[model samples]
Target: MTEIVFTPIGTVHSPFSDPRDMPIQPVGARGVRGTIELDPACAAGLQDLAGFSRIIVLYHFHRSNGYSLEVVPFLDKTPRGVFATRAPRRPNAIGISMLRLIAVDGATLTVEDVDILDGTPVLDIKPYVPAFDAYPDERAGWLTTTSGAARTMRSDDRFC
Candidate 1:
């Protein structure tokens, strides 16, 4: 395997300090607001981003300290491979979430529906294009059954 490196483009600011109390998915976090403080050098990247109602934030689960190939996810009772679930404990502690864009003020972006913990390191941001990103009929395998619980689900410290 080859080693790859990335610097944080920004830090995510959210109300949840403890991962245990945070929403497990954007659906559960609807209307929950937050902010992203980007480095000034990356301010130019914010241009025209306001046109997007939502953006996919690729971030590092900086607080995740370990990796496990198999573990029980929050919504399941049985163990599953890490790749099969969105559990933060993975080979790479990378996280992605689609958050509503409330406003973009230079390098600072006010957002909503955030599920990530506060101070998470943002790897990149991309506009969410419904035509290119949505998949209404896609099969989710184990996720299909699990995602149904999202409406009432909130994360606990099982992964943390």
Candidate 2:
């Protein structure tokens, strides 16, 4: 096996200090605002990033504990493989969110619908182009059975 390393380019500041009891997904966090303060060395990468209406955020799940290959997800009772659900506990401990870009100034970025915890380490950011990210006609697997749950589900101790 080989090891790969990544340096956090920035920190995310949000309303929730604790991971539990917060929105489990961006939909549940609709309108929740936050800021990403990029390290001075990485500020220049923000160029042209403001044009996108939405952006994909990749960050480390700093608070998540060790993971199991199968576990019960927040939206359902069944124990599914880790890869099948958006549960935080994973081998990589990396989380992703689609947030609405509100504004950008120097090394700071204003975004809304942030489901990530404050002080989380951001790995990367990418423009949310529907043509490349959205798949409306594809199946959502177990998500279909738990329809609309993400819009209301809140985090608990299940994965903490």
Task: Write down the TM-score of every candidate.
Answer: 0.98, 0.97
**RMSD, every candidate, angstroms:** 0.8, 0.8
Alpha-carbon error at 67 in model 1, in Å? 0.9
Clashes of 2: 0
User: Whole-model lDDT for model 1 versus the true structure?
Assistant: 0.93
lDDT of 1 by residue, 76-152 (tens): 99999999889998899999999999999989999999998999999999999999999999998988877878877
Model 1: weakest 10-residue lDDT segment is: 143-152
Consecutive 10-residue window with the lowest summed lDDT within model 2: 144-153
Candidate 2 on 8-82: residue-level lDDT in tens? 999999999988899999999999999999998988898999889999999999988899999899998999999
In TM-score terms, candidate 2 sits at 0.97
